[model samples]
Target: MYKKIRFLTILIFALIITAVLSTGFIYSISITNAPSKNSTSIVKDKGSENKAVNTKIKKLDSNSYNILVMGDSLARGTGDESNRGFANDFSSLWRAKAKKPIKVINIAVNGDVSSGLLNIVKDQQNLQYIQDSNMIFISIGGNEIKNFRSTDASSSVVQPNNEKAVQNSYLKNLENIFKLIRSKNQNSIVAFIGLYNPFGDDLTADKLELLNEWNYKTEDLVSSYDNAVYIPTYDLFKYNSQNYLAADNFHPNSAGYEAISKRIFESLKNFKN
Candidate 1:
């Protein structure tokens, strides 16, 4: 009886996956169809020009594959006014570049950080949708610090003044996530985008210092992962804060997010091998 029940459960799970995976299919098609240049954000003066940067999936022998990109508001495409966000732009570029289709499943929420991401992935529904991904991208850790800062006595900039200590715990969360992904798909490649400074002149110099410090540490932690590539956005956004940040002063705008996608695309485009 137990065996029969388990079989029925598996059958039901299969049906649900088939029903909900259409969006992912359409989403992949959208990415493959976008212009490669469409993902860049360039600024120019006189003869100078500036542009920003810009994934995939399929079967063992297929021409295409699926990639799952997960993270916080950055991944949600918050900074851009167009609301199309960098994720879509990146996918569009993939469509334009790859001989085969590349589907991207983006699971980034507005305020997700490390723990938040862990919490979300633990949920069976969301995890189910991401299982077959050919690769995964994570841009977490921005929202985690706010928890301690909200009522704490420390007027510290990024978090508890001792960020290295906090990162130790955060790294564990990253490890667990990768483990889960491996369990679901042994062949999947993973990349984690490092954090960037949201604070500019608006922040107290001390706060800015802390922000940079954290961004640096984020890249460090990301590097230690075997299956991960750390894509840096701190400088991309920091070089000019006002222009990069959204109206809210925290996230990146269309141009800013576009720059991030470019960085990510450059970092992992070699995954086809």
Candidate 2:
């Protein structure tokens, strides 16, 4: 009877050891099958890394285009917000799509006339920029006409006969302007921003006719050069003059500048290689 009891006690101890081993094996299997929080975190981090790499590549691709702007108050961004003018917008637009870097040289001044610009371009420093530029923007003749009309009458009404001398002078100066730019860089694309009527409904019939004549003359001048183009801005503010004009009712507002930039950007498509 004592021997039988000893054998039974040994069997009970063996069963206890087997139960502990079985429980440990089950726990190990559960851990091996489940997804870990750390693994998910690693995947998210890799996705972010890929996005950063793509952005870097885009920046690298956009570093080679150059632009030059020569005009009056409009090019200087007098009434636009932050003075980030059309030149700036044009460069940014090109960079975004062309994926290439761009350089902008805007030498436009407020109240500048075409004659004054002709003299400015004669300077060696300015000539260097003209030669280096791939594109050139010009906005003139407005100050020439407006300043001339203002001296004779305080009224915004522009008469055809009133601007005869100024108009003649403007056409000559503009011709010289194109000649000067082409002399430096024959390959640079030139874009002339035509004058817009700021008087809205208050504009006189004579003034409208004068503006149309000026635009036509400028377009004719631009046609003389292979690389030059004329961009008309008269209709943009014709009916919506008040909304697009700044507080002075002369310069374009921020929204108006944006519209001009969009037009310029559209023209750029023609020159793309």
CA lDDT scores, all candidates in order: 0.69, 0.79
Regions more than 4 Å wrong, model 1: 1-64, 146-165, 204-209
Give the clash count for model 1: 20
- Residue by residue across 1-273, what tens digits does model 2's lDDT show? 999999999999999999999999999999998889676332335548554444331111134666878879998888987588888877777777646578777888889988889898887668877877778889998887655333236544344465776788889988888888888889988888988988665655666677788899989998889877788888888877878888898999988888888887887676752
Model 1, global lDDT: 0.69
Expressed as tens digits, the lDDT of each residue in 2-57 for candidate 1 is 99999999999999999789879998999898768746545555654532211112
Please give the lDDT score for candidate 2.
Answer: 0.79
TM-scores, all candidates, are 0.65, 0.71
Q: Which window of ten consecutive residues has the lowest lDDT sum in model 2? A: 54-63
Q: Relative to the unseen true structure, what is the C-alpha lDDT of residue 41 in candidate 2, on a scale of 0 to 100? A: 32
Worst 10 residues of 1 by lDDT: 51-60
